[model samples]
Target: MIRGCIKTITCGKKLSRNTKHSNTSNTGNSNRHLPVYAKVAYILGLRVSPSHRRMGIGLKLVHRMEAWFRDNGAEYSYMATENDNLASVKLFTDKCGYTKFRTPSILVNPVFAHRLTLSPKVKIIHLTPSQAETIYRRRFATTEFFPRDIDAVLNNKLSIGTFLAVPDSATWQGTDHFLSDPPKSWAILSIWNSKELFTLQVRGASRVKRTLAKTTRVVDKALPFLRLPSFPDFFRPFGFHFMYGIGGEGPEAVKMVKSLCDFAHNVAKERDCGAVVTEVSGQEPLRFGIPHWKMLSCPEDLWCIKRLGEDYSDGSVGDWTKSPPRISIFVDPREV
Candidate 1:
């Protein structure tokens, strides 16, 4: 008998969801067929008490979730976990037949006391919830777990704002920059306020590691020129700016990415945030463009997937047993 349970989101057409995160509303169309964008099932907050461990309860919960997913219109079901979690790895792959598919690089960059000059060719536009949702739907259609209701993300108190970096047009000359010429590309950045969502307590550092952290902070304060890593206070309540739904392409892709990073960093600093973070697939072309701490990030998050059915048009479900050329990654802000 299962004493514990796992929560699952049906991902109805009107529901807003992302990989590892789903915020569902009562659509009253639960019995309707899955919408084109609602073919995914996100498993969230699975837990079993320690006393119930080693009794197959966890596996049973996942099995139940998968069944629920199939009964809905989910063609694929997926979740994210730490790479070092051996127990979850075994349970998902060995027992449940889920395949480990994507490993995206989660990079963290500190919010330093520096402001970047907005590029003359580009302007950052703060988008309203409706505008952000409409633009995101068209721009990130292929991205995995993209929320159908972007308003949920933008309206949340934890969200700072959704911004778009586009060319400074003839009619709209940006305040910081002129419209001498417009850039050929654009990008959207959604910043999530991690401090407001939940508290983070990062522990388990060794003595030497802890000492090094303190030393770096001292050096940063004293020298100010050496530019050592400025580690945030993990013990206290500090804010984090998580940038998500980054989109850009073409020759101007690199420039767009850099501007977006700078924009996010400046916003974080303004809000007294400790760090800025974003995740991208290892194969992302714009990966090198975003600013990040090199040694701090090395793709430690493991993305596992299970195909509930055979439709692969949306690219959320893939043949992970045989390696595909490119893997799709959709990092939901709620999942962060």
Candidate 2:
């Protein structure tokens, strides 16, 4: 019977037929997904039917995948769960050595915030039909993603925000957000004091060749659970927000994170944002590494699935792989 099921459940790009059913005494069909980053860790998207929850099936599934990872040359293992998903988090952090990383607060990444940004440091400047033509030519200067999306954001009359780097005072690095470009969540473009972000930015510039087809399937299935459009624009500014810094950061990078977190909680009065987010892999390796972590829930373990090396700096530095670059905690872009 077990061998028969294996023959029935045909292997495809998204799923693979496994031999777990070889015993046939089991009750439900075994399920497995070869995720987009599987070559790196083979994210275990497993379920053994609803009736199989407590039957030790979940743990067994994890072990099966773990063995597969070791065979496939996975040096490190990683995973993720929502902040409230205590069960999943416990399984990884408490049981497995997988780490965690807190996504930024939902305020800055809201889709409706794309409605129109009116910040004093920046202004919600509208792009006209005339101006768009000129900017279109200049869009492809540094990055390749802007050219097409810029036109769309302008067409939607999307509000744009950017921090004009004050020359000399500090390196020109500011974050900007718009509704249409990137065609997913809000887009963030940051310039730092040094070349760290640039080095870190490209770590995941492309999808993992090994996991692309399967990744597209997961994105299709899990999309229904995401709720990013609920938050609105005109969000109060919070000085507390910080993202990962790749490459390398200031000699006082740790002190900077603590000070920023404190300002956001105590001074800015934003409860949602307790720490900064970082793309530590290439550009800002320590974006999540708050050396002297001072904020509540400031730094946590992140199960970075990519296997860069043991010196991964743990959850303190950016570890990039061929995975999707997701700005966790940001508003869903569906409503935008």
Candidate 3:
């Protein structure tokens, strides 16, 4: 019988900078000017039988996976887990040499019985894949961990579409000239439908809670005008729409972002998605614009990463864990 198993996937390259240390022998100019990319891999679903605990099987599995990553030309490997998972934290950080890299929060907003209203003054424009790709590449190329294969992502069948929200008063420039002269206040986001790929279910709810949930759903359905807050049947298999590449600019950008989020919620309701979700860096400013429930969201999702091979001493490759949080992150929807 199989005692344990782990899964790994090679994500696309990410833009990163190499910190120049004085002790490095090379006198070449700082690698900052030249763009440096690291081929990244993600480890997930590591499992071991309870009876085999503390037998070093977990470490062996990690080592084997790391070897495979290096063989596949992965320069960096990372994994995400709940912040409270102490065992996972110890194994990856203490035993596997991975360091805490990023703390991004998973924001989840459930679809409600009543449709969310968008502002009359805010107009949302759907962008074609080509247009979306151009904007992402030009604006977010320098963002930390930006995927190199962004074109593929935009073209993927699961990607619904990318959208831009701007004040209706702004003169609408053609899509081609958007980069040159952007609107004064604007927000952009993309949606990925993951229902066909996978679904989620909630377990271990008490009988009383389940009854209360069912009653609430029934009442909400009967009286939607009341706008009672009712949750979907999370006890069963349910899928969600993921919003990614969320960003905005200008003083009124926050309102634009909120309008976009309302639009996404309405779309999710039409598609029968249980929730609309997105992950943003802990320090991201635009996060305030995204609407989510505190009880249903993860406030501190942990991502740990480590460099592969003997190039650990290379000063040209900066320590990603120590990178500043000010730079925005592009959460790859494919990884979801």
Candidate 4:
């Protein structure tokens, strides 16, 4: 039963997505944060009230939301669903033309949700709202999720929600995130009773490059990840290089992937996962060079770009001087 929204903006903040919601609320109220970037407007918690069943309310909402996102500055609008969900699958993929990302996984924990092994020098801790805003200015030049700007590693709120990374594994260090107020950046680990599925999706990616010392490792040493014994034929673990659109150089993106790999490993170990997977498409210099993890699925998931209207070209003057890795993460919809 998707209903009203409660959007908010920060003081002197450019766009207003710094909005928060309450248990009594249904959706975000404003589009202040949305007008700022080439964004994705996903209709979450889609449902049907008793009288609304089979009334096309869900489909109509999708059309309405898509229209709103387009009206606001979103270049692409998106959403996802499980393959078994016939109605959702048909609505988004078939009717709306939303493409499905590969390599989906569900993570679970009997006692807790994840594991963390953060570096001693780079202490992992949670951030307050003010701290998050400050960090955002440092991390992103433009185009951000407002909240995603903060370092999830130390944010306690991220943990209760979901985030963990193990950097400098030689030192046995890592970070974690929770989904509560003032999110958790240091909930070290959550030992699970059984195995959990670790999944990654590439919502967007482009080519990038940078220089790494020969001795410098790119993949983080910790993350609860393991390649499943068998992969479905249609699966193709896609990876994208995002440094291009974001305007960061290649080396920076490489460093980021290395950190993410470490986090992935820590997550796998905590939840007893079996593998880490990523698909590299159209190998460019940046897409190459990094260590190739095992490919659980094929590498033929062709990404077809369809344009509607307006200035489809991204405005960038400089070229990527170096090549780094391309990696985009997708989802881990908790069934809990």
Best by lDDT: 3
Candidate 2 lDDT tens digits, 163-198: 211112232222212211111111122211111111
TM-score of each: 0.73, 0.30, 0.86, 0.37
- Tell me how candidate 4 scores on lDDT: 0.33
User: By how many angstroms RMSD does model 3 differ from the true structure?
Assistant: 6.3
Task: Put down candidate 3 lDDT per residue, 1-336, tens digits, no spaces.
Answer: 112112222222232245433343221221223334566777766888999999999889888888888787776788888999999999999999999888999999988867777899999999999898877776665566677778888999999999999889766566656666678789999999988799999999998999998888888889988878888888888999999988877898888999999999989989988999999989888888999999999999999988786665444446555665644678888878
Q: Rank the models by TM-score, top first.
A: 3, 1, 4, 2
What is candidate 2's CA lDDT for residue 236? 31
Q: lDDT tens digits, residues 1-336, model 1?
A: 322112222222332343214343222122122333545566665678989899999998988878877776666777777799899888888998888877888998876544555688877788777667765554454454556656677788888888777766634344223122334566677889886776555677777777776666677778766655567555455778888878765587767778888888888878877778899888878777788887656576787777776655543333433445244355678767
RMSD of 2: 21.5
When 3 and 4 are scored with lDDT, the better candidate is 3
lDDT of 4 by residue, 35-150 (tens): 23233344544677868677778878767766766676555543434446677777666666666543222221111123444334222332344443333333232322222323
**C-alpha RMSD values across all candidates:** 8.9, 21.5, 6.3, 15.5
Better of 1 and 4 by lDDT: 1
Off by over 4 Å in 4: 3-37, 112-148, 151-311, 314-336
